[model samples]
Target: MASPRELTTPATLTEESVRRYREDGFVHVPRLLSPEEVSVYRAAAESILERDMEVWAGGDDGAAVEVNYTTQVWRKDETLRRLALHPALTGIAGRLAGVPLRLYSSEVLVKEPEGAPPTLLHDDEAGLPMDGLEQTLTAWIALVDVPVERGCLSYIPGSHLRADSERLRHMTSFEQFREPDEVWPDFPWRPRVTVPLRAGDVAFHHCRTLHWAGGNETDARRVGHGVIYMDAGTTYLPGVMDEYLAHMEPGQPLDDAELFPIVTS
Candidate 1:
């Protein structure tokens, strides 16, 4: 088990654990940080909720929402910035990506109590418009205790290695990600697995993994941080990309230090 203060320090990832990521496309790393250490991160999250955050909102303006998924929280405060650049994540990303990784973005995905809407099955890569779509993933760390009842994620094992990945790659929208297993009847995947984690436990997942979280059935809120990691030197794809890319140059590579600095090299 990791001590509270050792939260920022990198853990020695075992070969077997790395192999799990290679094969399954997702692995839950235990004791990534202690609950005491996670308090600071929780504070950061609370601070974010306290203000008018420039959150993506996941289509909900405020009321009658599915989940209060917010983005760019790292841009607002110091604790969030530290969590985004934490060396522990980069160390793991270096091993997983087999190349230096950069911070793509940091977000808070919160599911409020009283049956918050479930997250429909979807992959992070298809939603992102990067040309090197496969060169990215999300490092998720639960900010609070997350059981299946509290909106934890469930992933279809080995779906990232599917043959019809291209078809699964660029979905027009999350609503459009109807069960791919049905579309490609031959899609190779085992039954989905629901991830359960306490505060500070982490899960690393490939960008293309078909995953979803159930509605929050518990009385408390479910919250976690997703720090985006992209392999260095990925570029923007113009026409097929999301609306956010309208500001950047069409052919520009996303290697900007100020925005997407190298987390590991």
Candidate 2:
């Protein structure tokens, strides 16, 4: 590997890119990150994943289901936090969402080599367990080369328009969420490109965009770092909320500087 390059803030989001994201509910930003930077953070992500595995293994009755996971890891890893707060990506997220932003969560997804389970097609807002929400977005950064066969993300075009697909919102449980084809029978499948990523590319999608990943059959693992951002000034609605944020009390404002600090360039 070559020496790491000087890490700086990300470039401004282009008008066409923003337009594409608004129209499609998802946009692929090519090479938003440098290979050197991805390499550095890839190791960081893997370390946190391996560390979690060890913890699970060390516990009593350590044997768990054979599955794919590595969620909410940034809480413990500094390197992950760095990537989550990187200005380049956050700048685009803020612009796309048309609001200041704060991190909702940072998760690491690992699709292990050979027959790794595919991610369920679902919307991020559905599982929030809250009602009346701000426009949130997710930045999915590819840490390694991810082809379609390796479980790259597939999204439904224009799925963000509430008027276009509102009835499907009630199906929020990711466990019960099915592939996009069955969601809205009236809209029909639109002929469009799927969102895949290179090692350093970042794909930003609206929180409610219909998306899914296929099973990974490759020998190489496909791993990605994902950051979800909520519109600034958004609050937690414990009344309709669920277990995801059980730690925090109900009705707490989400723009907590110490916890979900704003990511500004």
Best by lDDT: 1
List, residue by residue over 217-249, the lDDT tens digit for candidate 1. 899988888998997878876543367567888
Each prediction's Cα lDDT score? Answer: 0.77, 0.72
Per-structure clash totals for the candidates: 0, 1
Q: Write model 2 residue lDDT over 1-265, tens digit each, in one string.
A: 2234433234444688888888889988877788888999999988888877422121226332223446666677888888998878888787788777778788887777887656666677766644445578899999998898887888877777756355354433435544555656644645545667889888888887877777788899888988888876666665322566677765667766867788752
What lDDT would candidate 2 get against the real structure? 0.72
Please name the candidate that would achieve the greatest TM-score relative to the true structure. 1
After TM-score superposition, the amount by which residue 218's alpha carbon in candidate 1 deviates from its true location, in angstroms, is 0.8
Q: Give the Cα error of residue 94 in candidate 2, in Å.
A: 1.3
Q: Candidate 1 lDDT (Cα, whole model)?
A: 0.77
Which pairs of residues have clashing backbones in candidate 2? 10-88
- Spell out the clash pairs found in candidate 1: none
